[model samples]
Target: MTEPGGGGRTGWVAPLCWSAVALEGFDLVVLGVVLPSLLDEPAWGLTPATASLVSTAGLLGVMVGALSAGPLADLLGRRRAMLATVVSFSVLTLLCAVATGPWTFGALRFLAGLGLGGVLPVALAMVNEYGRSGRGGSATTALMTGYHVGAVATSLLGILLIPVWGWRAMFVAGALPALVLVPLLARYLPDSRPQPPPATGAARSRNPVAQLVRDGYLRSSVAFWVASFMGLLLVYGLNTWLPEIMRAAGYGLGAALAQLLVLNIGAIAGLLVAGRVADRTGVRAATPAWFAGGALFLALLAVPLPGAGIYLSVLLAGVFVFSAQVLVYAHVSQHYPDHARASALGAASGIGRLGAISGPLLGGGLLSAGLAYPWGFFAFAAVAALGAVAVLAVPRAVPARAR
Candidate 1:
């Protein structure tokens, strides 16, 4: 069957998918934005340890959502899955505004995380399926720029809203966009056609996860998982704690939050650049190079710099750090067959959430020890280097048809 919006009429696909990803991006940085305020609220009794636990709870939910959503989307249809996820998360996020305690808030976050986690792979698969032929790299990165666009907006909103309206306002604001977004999705988003049956009868019966490790795909699958873990470690660790880290480094809260804003702004710029470069140089070469650049910039963040110098450093770090993770998704989409593409992306994202969980814990631990500044940057830099090395192991080849 011909896919809906195929034949190069995918205008709706990009905007709807991009908007879905933007919501996920809002969740990505919202907690970090409100974290400092939460800590200051005496009634909640939140400490670094508890905050990390809350963050972990949310990430754990995301991991489960990602792992299950891929197969579910493959079975039920992407349009239905996307709409369900958006509604589920938006309602849960709105409830977060009324959470009575940290545990209650954490529970809501975990519940909302389930929907947030599912959005990425599902939206990604849809975009790739309907995207311009042979521009998978650009297509993937372009969609992801919405991720940072939302994040950048959240950071700015936090700065403006949190102080005046309080921390709960951020959650309320995060969910409100979905009201407009969901209607657009339900009205315009088209369901993707199911993948054709496998060539062999035996292969046809096998599930998406099994197809990942079979047929000479084990090495690439394993490599993608490892690289994704490290990439997300950097992405989540910094987004969740960079403002606090900057605070620990002696900057005021406003300046620290501004740094977070700068970081994602740089991420938007990086995503735009990385896509074109990856498309031109080949994702295989470009992915590793971006990770390596991320490592270098992350390590540079350890150095103490003057005001302008520090913002520039954070911007550079954002440029390389965030897009490095998205490139992994681009690479996976190009390497895998359509039959198992969402499954592969989901598995990679789900496994990467483990690193996402660890990222906050790592930062929380460092902050608790009063070593968040130099040490956190060093630790994050090492993870980026590992990401570079892991992707290097995934043999330099895209499927013939994919290319």
Candidate 2:
């Protein structure tokens, strides 16, 4: 690890990267947690559809941010970009807490989404660069695990704090981590050395996204985008509606809420483990199997199984759901050279953000139509199977060093 500042502990880098990802996780989940409270507030005047629209807007902002942040990070350097994104989202979230009306809240969330979108790719790039070469998959997975941790924490906080303090408190709580951590990030994070342009010369160096389309990379890129779409679709869908799903499946409200916790715990473990396993056996080999298992698990949930089966299904779903998308990212980082890595990651995430938006909408549509719980799980399973096959179809590229 070439310590950008000085070297005592490159160890701190992975943890900091994880912390940054945790903030992104918080931003995504907190709104869902606080939604019921927000709807009940006369001041906000949120109808169910309106509230859903607001959530969709945030996803759109995230997509825009994801697509744009990579080139910006490459131009700006990773450390400055990551810290700036953290501070930017923090301030926007604070604004969200203070805003009184729907318009203001939506606008703030959109801006916050920009910050939220930018942080992930930059963080992933940094971690991938600093992490031991053989352990890139595991290191990236560990960093991403923080996102699940934040999501789980926010869910608990919402259950505990909202009865006393209301939805604003949740946003306020969200802001605190960034405020405390931004300074630490500002001081400690190291910027990876941006790779110089390809020696093929200035003519070919124009657009990084365009570069990805050349050299047979177009196939891999499309496969990743499809896989990411399915992965995030499952993630956001479950987070948005798991409680309701559980309640419909005959669990009490308390048990329904607890299942979310159990699911995220599995996610955390999956992130920590998936990378190491992928590193040992190519990311290509590891990811398809994970998705297939996830598909089966999600399908199993739809059956009116015993209590143990429900918990087991959720735990297993969490294992594959979150890590599967991240493994796509690791594959991109490993597949692309550094100069284009961020851009590729960003594009894939940007595309996947579209899927993220759809997940909630799909869930709401299914639930509104009174589709059986099994159909929903079956649908998610289909998505997973599609993603697995999509990933498998793309021809694997040999690393240049190996080539």
Candidate 3:
């Protein structure tokens, strides 16, 4: 099939979209990286409570942005929307470096969250549309690897830059990539064709949100939302609290931290494997299987294992846990019509942010009660099981046009 842009240069889409996603991933972890330094500064008078408020504010903005960006993308072209979001967030993130107080910092974070939230759905939509036919699963999973790459890079940067330069430098570094990324997007990103008007007067009056429920999509839409919620819950819950939870389970701090790294490494491996399998066997089969594998591994972590056994379990858990969510995204991209694709993706992502917020709270609650070890694993296992069941409810068949 011909590429989205002429002259067979569609290669640019994946790299460009991957870079955009990496920026979002950088933002995702930057707060965690900088929070310690912020607390150390006596002048800011930053408290844990205020820090929580700032974090929550950014997430809430992301949720709102995710909810809004899809329909906006469907109405406006993807290239335009993508450029606007990137510029908006980059400028706001740069400003975060210079904020005077907690309130100012948090306000900037919230503003940046709006752009960060918009990036994923739009990028996913762009890659899916531009990619070769029948490879949506591979294309999406490949694009998402940039997320982990960005995250890992930020962690390393935090270790290196924070001690030498300070926390403010991190935000400036995060924003600097946009200087290169935005211009390339403007010059190379192809504009998707405008969505045609709905046929009937009634259809024309119905909004994109309403259309998700009106057609044969009601069941699948709800299923995707449920699956997304559970998927992100496992993701955020584990990432936020795994080290502490392992420490609670009697592991040393070094080992616990090492396991966290193992988990993400497993995630990258999983993305690589899951996408190809999904493309060959179909996302309908692969998504639930991955979730089930995640459930099994999470449950095994509850059992006391030898040192290597524990690392192996965490690694396997990471493999299934992370990619399972991305497969849900692959399914959404393959199932929805061109008009509703971005909207559906945005809704799933927006709703999933609630799970992201809830995951850390759940982990914190479990830790406070001294139940974070076995109970935490058990709880995450149950959530993974639910994700599997939720994906099963989506019909096996997608529309021919979507295929």
Q: RMSDs, each prediction?
A: 3.3, 2.6, 2.4
Best by lDDT: 3
Ranking by lDDT: 3, 1, 2
In the range 1-403, model 3's lDDT, one tens digit per residue, is: 1224322245677898999999999987999999999999899999999999999999999988898888788777677788889999999999999999999999999999999999999989989988999899999999999999999899999999999999999999999999999989887887764464456445542356665675567888999999999999999999999999999999999999999999999999999999999999988899999999999999999999985999999999999999999999999988877877778889999999999899999999999999998999999999999999999999876543223
Cα lDDT, all candidates: 0.87, 0.82, 0.89
The worst-scoring run of ten residues by lDDT in candidate 1 lies at 1-10
Off by over 4 Å in 3: 1-9, 197-202, 398-403
* lDDT, candidate 2, 1-403, per-residue tens: 2337522245667888888888888886788788877888886788988887788778888899888888777766777778778898899998898888887888889999998998898888888877897887897788887887787788788988888988888898888887678877877777654754656635454456665676567788888889989989988888778888777777899999889878888887888779889999988798898899889889988887775878888998899878888898888888876767778889889899988988877887888888737688888889899989988976777434312
Best by TM-score: 3
Q: What tens-digit string does per-residue lDDT give for candidate 1 at 1-403?
A: 3255322245788988999999898887788789999999999999988997898889899999998888787766788889889999999999999999999999999999899889999999888888888788899999998887787789899999987999999989988988898888877787775664555645542567776776667899999999999988888788779999989888999999899889988898999999999889988889999999999988898999976999999999999999999999999988877767788889999999988878877898999999998898999999999999999999766444232
For candidate 1, give the lDDT of residue 218: 80
Pick the winner on TM-score between candidates 1 and 3.
3
Stronger candidate by TM-score (1 vs 2): 2
**173 Cα displacement, candidate 1 (Å):** 2.9
Backbone atom clashes (below 3 Å) for every candidate: 0, 0, 0
Give the poorly placed runs of model 1, Cα more than 4 Å off. Answer: 5-9, 36-43, 159-166, 204-206, 243-260, 303-311, 366-375, 397-403
